[model samples]
Target: MEAKTAVNVGQLSRKPELKPKRKIKWKNVLTYAAFVGPALLFFVVIQIIPFLMGIYYSFTSWNGISAAVDWVGLENYKKIFTNDAKFFNSFWFTTRFMFAAVVISNLLGFGLALLLNGALKTRNILRTVFFMPNVIGGLLLGFIWQFIFVKGFASVGKYTDIGIFKLAWLGDEATAFWGIVIVFAWQTAGYMMVIYIAALQGVDQSLVEAARIDGASNWNVLTKIMMPLILPAFTICFFLTISMAFKIFDINISLTNGGPFNSTESVAINIYREAFQYNNFGLGTAKAVLFFVIVAVFTTVQVVMTKKKEVEA
Candidate 1:
């Protein structure tokens, strides 16, 4: 009887030890919730809720001013697909803009990063100057550049008789498109350069030393060692630029206003007009949903491709 009683007590004592682990687990969960709960709550309330509402709104004919919303099934999507030439035109323009903006901005940013990453007396000053444009609001930046293209360029061309500057930047389709690209690249490159600078600074100097000690050539060290390591920066920069370029709005509005025959109309402007200007909220929401899907897919693919490379590295 005594032996049996001791075994039961031994098992009961082991069970108490398990209770501490359960308490520890619960404590960790509560700690995490305490720290992250507010942000998560805000995100759900602000972002997720609105997004869900937007999705619901896409299926109804809810004019901006109307309290009555009529269920329209997929009619809005149908119209967008079968009859909306303007939307597609906007999509095409945005696509081309995205490509040009992403390429030029990234190249300029990466170049500036490389330049300032080296030992230079004025690098800090240059960094601040470069990043200053990005600090300016997009609307303000657009208006400033519009004046530059319209008045400043004209004056410079008048004196210099430069054919390039003499061209009507905002007054024509081709020039208008490139004008936005130039301004966007100029504004964003500096910001991107900062990101790259951080990533470049983060590279392990010890690894570079090891490579050099192993008789690795400078080019090899840069190509094989540095490039692979800083791949994450490229991922981040490309992702940001792609998203920014695709969903462009303020610059388009202040600079071109989709003028010279609506050549520069972005999907964002198109959706805005559909909702507020034209009062076709349903159609606008549908377009927005589609735009969201396209952007999500594009960014997802980019992240996946870049993440694969990161893994390989």
Candidate 2:
């Protein structure tokens, strides 16, 4: 009896312990899916699918409405590289415009932020006034500026007799370029100012007080301390301005309409004319791809450089 009991006990000890498998909680998963499903569906449908179609179209000789899209391989790209003079000219114009607009807008924005950071009675009203232009659509703003450059400036020039104002603002190439720059800066500066103001407000006031007590000059404090602390804001503002300036289209269209012998033509306007006006969808898509590459590269470099400075500061 004792030996049989020991054998049973040994058998029981040798048996493997059973554990329950973890069941996937479908309820929790479904809850998360319910939240993320719509946005993910829209993103895939709207952005990803169109982007893929654009890439495919870039390789074909599709005239946007033809029955058949004939694959041309690298022909379009080859033409863009070797045979497209106007496209390259538009690219050059875009580059120059971007540099001018970015610098001027950021300077004005940062200056305004500094001025308003102080305890001014009218700061709230001034901020509202400055930012009002940004609330208006770019097309409307462009039209408004166009009117101002034409009739309003003509009237002001007539009264003041200023030669600068008297010059045909949108007719002459040089003046037209500067005129666009002025309008772009005016419209965008306020947006940048608001960003800079948020960054300025977050900065430690104690540091400024301590620097003042130490007899640090305003310039020194600004350059050494405040600028470093606000480096992230500069990064954000520069990135915003760079992208906006590079992709400038609506304002460029409504303001100048790429006029004066197409000297003021932007890459976006050029792309539009090529695709819709000229009915060369393949070539336009190719140009658009190149434009995207240039913008991506430039903005990436800018962000990387600024971030490095931010880390150092």
Candidate 3:
């Protein structure tokens, strides 16, 4: 009995100890939930819910205020496709404006970047000056430019006797289109310039020096080496300009109010009028949906094409 008791004690002593697993702290999870919950709630309430509701309302003939909302089943879209002349015209105008604005803004921005990339004494100050216009709201900028076009240009023309400045810039259709382009480029080019300058600074200076040593001219160096290196910046700038120009509203409204027989009216302005002015919420929502599709497709195509060029480069 003594020997058996001793053996049992030894066995018990040799056995390894085991510990209980720790439970997950629900407090930490609650803390994270407390932090992230409100933002998610607001995003859903503000953006997602409204967007989904707009989609539903697009198929209904709701006047936006009354409780009566009759389902129309694509009638709004059908009217837009078959009978909306003003909307189509505005769409065409917007398309043309987008093309012009993108090209001019990118070119000017790139040029400014090149000029500022050099060691100029006043480049920093000039960059700040150029970018200042972008800080102002588009609506405010439009109003400011309106005064310049109406009074300031007239005053300058009166003194300098320049026929170009004397011409009715906002009153005529062709000139109004170009006028908007000029203001848009002026406002946006600075922002693009800042982007290009950053990209330009990232270019390999040794490659440029090697090209220079190989008897390459400045033009060739820019075209062959710098352009390829900075293609990504071009892609970004083009995308931004395209999106902004496509959905332009404030500047168009404050500048010309789509006057001169609504010649300079954009698709955005048309949608606003359709919804608020004419009280056609369903049609407006339908136009908005179509606008969204066009913008998505165009930007996607642009990004894909530019990305392919980037890989080739």
TM-score winner among the candidates? 2
Cα RMSDs of all predictions? 3.6, 3.7, 5.3
lDDT of 3 by residue, 191-242 (tens): 9999999999999999999999999999999999999999999999999999
Candidate 2 clashes: the total is 0
Candidate 3 wrong stretches, greater than 4 Å: 1-39
What is the Cα-based TM-score of model 3?
0.89
Instruction: Give the least accurate 10-residue stretch of model 3, judged by summed lDDT.
Output: 15-24
TM-score for each model: 0.89, 0.92, 0.89
Q: What TM-score does prediction 2 earn? A: 0.92
Best by lDDT: 3
lDDT, each prediction = 0.94, 0.94, 0.96
Per-residue lDDT tens digits of candidate 2, residues 1-313?
9999999999988969789899999999999999999999999999999888988999999999988999999999999999999999999999999999999999999999999989999999999999888888889989999999999999999999998779999999999999889988999999999999999999898999899999999998899889999999999999999999988898999999998899999999999999999999999999998899989999999999999999988
Give Cα distance to truth, residue 108, candidate 2, Å. Answer: 0.8
